[model samples]
Target: MDRLEKMLVDIRAFVAEREWEPFHDPKNLAMAVASEAGELLSELRWVKGEDADAHCREPEARRRVADEVADVAITLLMLADRIELDLPAEVHRKLVKNREKYPVEEWRGR
Candidate 1:
């Protein structure tokens, strides 16, 4: 299987093992995504934009940020799966729409 498929399979197995599918409804998963994103943002709280990269570069900070990022991704993926979304296709479609709205030539260096 492709990488994305494999990742989804693993996530599915993980939830199955934990008997978490009952709790993996789209609404809850979406809320979990937001909560995880908040955690990630908290890790960078008070960090200046210029220093944000360096702040997360610290080993402990990086690990914490990575964990929060993973949580957000996992929850998002769960939500997408629960809603029967074709994520890659939706992303591509959005990108196309965005490109039309913000054409590169018109938006460059903005």
Candidate 2:
């Protein structure tokens, strides 16, 4: 399987190992995602551009970021799996929609 598939499989196994799947309902998972995202944003509370990049380069800070990112991904994937959603397909569909909304030729303000 590809990297993302492998990661998802591993995440599933990790959740199952902890017997956390039962608690991973859509609402809770979405809340967990938001919390993790908040944690990520916290790292940059007073930082800007180059400073934020430098903060990410530090080992401990990088680990914290990775942990938060993993938490968000785990919650998101669990929610998607619970709803029988095809993540890759949904991602493609969303990208297509976004492309229509903000075409390259008309895109501005990164």
Candidate 3:
């Protein structure tokens, strides 16, 4: 299987092992996602582009970013799995919508 599928499987196993699924309601998962995103943003607070990129390459910074990213992904995957959402298909659909919304030619100027 692909990396994402493998990761999802691992996440499922993790949740099952901890018996945390019962607490992973949509609202709680959404909050978890937001909280993790905020933590990720905190890493770049007041940092410029180059500095932020450099920070991301540091082992400690990378680990922090990875943790926040995993947290967000886990919550999202749990919510999606609970609701039976097809993640890859939805991602492609959203990409198509985004392409339509921000066509290259029109957006190139900005």
Q: What is the C-alpha lDDT of each candidate?
A: 0.93, 0.86, 0.87
Cα-based lDDT at residue 72, candidate 3: 79
Error of 2 at 51 (Å): 1.3
Cα deviation at 82, candidate 3, in Å, is 1.5
Query: Which prediction has more favorable lDDT, 1 or 2?
Result: 1
Across 19-74, the per-residue lDDT of candidate 3 in tens digits comes to: 99889888988888888889889877888887888889899989989988887788
Indicate the TM-score of model 2. Answer: 0.86
Query: Measured by C-alpha RMSD in angstroms, how accurate is candidate 3?
Result: 1.5
Better of 1 and 2 by TM-score: 1
* Tens-digit lDDT string for candidate 2 (1-110): 99878878998898889998789888888888898889888877888786888899899999988888887787788778878898999999999999999988888766
Model 2: runs farther than 4 Å from truth?
none
Error of 1 at 25 (Å): 1.2
Clashing pairs in 3: none
Best by TM-score: 1
Model 1 per-residue lDDT tens digits across residues 1-110: 98878889999999999999998888888889999999999999999999998988999999999999999988888898999999999999999999999999999999
All candidates' TM-scores? Answer: 0.95, 0.86, 0.89
TM-score-sorted candidate list, best first: 1, 3, 2
Quote the lDDT for 75 in model 2.
76
